[model samples]
Target chain A: MWLIKHIPPMAKALICFTFVLVITSVLIWLLNPVIIPVLVSLALYVCLLPLHDWLTNLGWRRDMSAMAILFLMMFVVLVPGSLILAEFNEQAMLWQSKASIAGQSLNELLGLLSEKLAQWQFHIEVDQLKANILAGLVKDNGSFLSSISSLVMSISSSLLLVPFITFFLLRDFESLRNKSLNSLPNKYFELGWLMYFKVAKQTQGYVRAVLIQQSILAVVAASGFWLAGFDSPVILGLIAGVLGLIPYVGPALGLLPPFYLVLANPEVGFDAMYTAVLVIGVAYLVDNLLVIPLVVARFANLHPLVALLSIIVFGNFFGILGMIAAIPLLAISNIVFYQLLLSFSPKKFTTNVASFH
Target chain B: MAGSPFWQNLFRPDHKQKKHVRDLWLATPIFSGVSANQCQQLVNDMAIRRYENTEAVFKLGDVGIGTGLIISGSVRICMGEKVLAQLEEGDFFGEVALVIEAPRTATAIAAGDTQIVFFLRPQLESLLSRSPRQGAKIMQNLAKVMANRLGSTNTLLEQSHVAD
Candidate 1:
């Protein structure tokens, strides 16, 4: 009671805010499963704004532009994505079929191996282990297929959510921002405005640069693959190009499907792998060196590690939506937190803020 | 720069005939991507206007209805006797006239013999509609201008405190 009487209002507010953060973190951790999809939708919104702009500039109205973007997302992202899934499943099934077809052949080899092992006095039962593993896989096939079907259904639903959220975000962003800004408490109003606007500029610059660079990479990769006579060359280029947006992990994730496709084919897989790998490596290098450095980082300047951390921390606290929202969240928070410190802090802090803003 | 090839004559451009095409091409930012020949060709679609030294190009109360760019020499933006800003070669003027069709806000005078390439609002509008990139570039420049103005105002406020 004595402490409550003495504690200042601002200090009390800060304490209250801290408590809110803790509670929010708890809530987000619980709700992450649903929140992650919304986060994915928001990422699509940020990444796709420039495409919408380009189409609108070309004389398509906003609604038409939104429709065009949705269509492109379906064909470029969803269709190819679904095809890759079906294709991978087909290859996996072939491998599964071969496991059975090659089962008799495998038993014979295992018998020869066990004989050689027994000859060497190494009592390892190679034939028995192979038979046991095959039996387990056969028993689990029903559960495995059911799970795969569920995964496919959820992905298709998420794909549909992206365009729905994206169209609204793109259309109503300015009004939403204005309304939110007006809602800030009077004491913090100016700081909030400056922080939000600065963050908006950085986000806009990043989204703009990435969209432009990714589109260029997609066309170039698609064209090169097309020239190389790879089946679904456009598909390869698109997968590689869009995945390049994910920072370090994106490029690695993009490489897998193509590798599978290569391994499946008899004559073309190796060449396709080599070409796809080269294109992706070069595209990755260009994106890191030229596109990101010259364009996004000049304004944003948050390194890949920092960006990744922001995603993880924010995602953990805010759910996956927080992860997707992390970059912009960090941008605005840096501004607001610093600005608050500035009013009473040293002059040097203000200078850094000036240059950054 | 557009009509008068050798601006070496620091006194003034002798021809003083505004090259419409040159000014139009230079007035835009996105046109930076256009080929040199194409820029020249665009200038041919424009009209030129001349301003005399120390004469008012447009005043705070004057009626004005065109958009243009400085082709040669410069203009001083003034409020009464105090010079508020400078517009040098390649600097644009009368932009607000295109944007809002508003009356002049301040007096613009030729600091020296000035020639400008201009297009009536309708012609300028038509040209911009055909080239959205160029138009967006112009809008970007306009944002830059407004930002610079905001910076100057902050500096002025600081200077006022220093004088006190």
Candidate 2:
């Protein structure tokens, strides 16, 4: 351990980074089941930082301000969340009925395609194909329901834990950070603060951008769905908004629900599907052209390949929550790595260039 | 900065010592006229570190982000081989860094095992946003300290010129 002191500054940074990464990974692995709640609390902590600062500026003590913010958040979320859940429940029941008819129609369409293929000497077996498809669907549905139930259980547990964690984080995060930095050797202490502030600022901005991006996508998509005359515009909009957080494939996935609903009324199905597609297409175009460029691009300028790879890897390990968090987490990591790398550059040791002094 | 558990427990700063350190901060020109309660609040945001004897607190040309107040023992401020000043208990160095993150003009090393409290630029910025009145008072005091130092330096220059 004393040998660490003799290493070059760049090496020290690398060692520190590796140690931190390993510790974090191990902690996350150990806390795998509760990771979601912890992550949610952290996200809430970051998102509410500005409001926390504003309240403290108004002469409120940190604990009181944090408490008030938590209360405000609960009120803001619960009221709308309950309303949305009710609407979603009603729409979901309707969708379930429509889905059965849609499934039958899709099977018939597939059968027709198989018949046409048989005429071309493809030797298609429509009956066998249909049976296999039904079996697979049943199996998938069974797994999906189990997964959903487990997800609900975790979320219910998290609902109790998130506030308690966020409260402590809100009140004591700075001191906690300082205490952690206190363990650093004297030589790296200032550098530690520099990195801490830089990372915190970047992460905060990225989280804020994500919140705004998600809201815009949800509002725009829901409005579009409503315009398309869908019975469950809000639910569809919510799904689309969340899915749209994913990069390239998300917008396509967002199309599935409306298409399913359209299938129930086969005569006018194509017309409604076309309208829905156009509406969503315009929304996606606006997001890519306007919102993403202005809000998210400034912080999360990750390569498409990197984003996709990260999403797949994280999804495999952590499921849907991981997929949603992949981009932001990746961006934060990139910022930390970049800052650590910057510490190695000789240019940084130069005299301050600020005109203020 | 980790000490053996035995040594850590042995040298652990007590409430009395901490209060004494706060009192020392209150006496400093940069914190002059600040209320003790306000000083306590500001001090809560600062950091303290212990340096071994002959250890460099910071080296020349190192980026300085904050001022350091010696809480115990002594510090030797030097440039190259020349001794610039020997700062004792309650003395502060690198105060300019609190205003701007300039390179430290001189290196500071501990004369003995020394404990120093740091009031960094980031904390100052946080204070400014969170409690502007307290922040402004400290900044005002900091300006006055700089002005007095500049006046003394100017007088010293004038005296040398007249002697020549």
**Fnat scores for every prediction:** 0.00, 0.32
Candidate 1, residue B46: Cα displacement in angstroms equals 39
In candidate 2, stretches whose alpha carbon ends up further than 4 angstroms from where it belongs are A1-12, A82-100, A105-157, A247-249, A263-268, A289-291, A342-348, A351-357, B1-11, B32-35, B60-64, B96-106, B136-164
Per-residue accuracy of model 1 over A192-220 as CA lDDT, tens digit each: 44445455556666666766787777777
Error of 1 at B21 (Å): 43
| Candidate 2 pairs with clashing backbones | none
lDDT of 2 by residue, A1-357 (tens): 787556777776687678768987999899887787888789889888878999987779999999998788677765666567666656655655565676676677677788888899887676677556444332244332223334444655567677778888999998778777766778777777766776676667767776677778888888988877887788778777766776666677677667766765576556687888887787778777755666556667877788889988986776656777787778777766666655554445544321111
lDDT minimum window of 10 residues, candidate 1 chain B: B5-14
RMSD of 2: 5.1
Poorest 10 consecutive residues by lDDT, candidate 2 chain A: A137-146
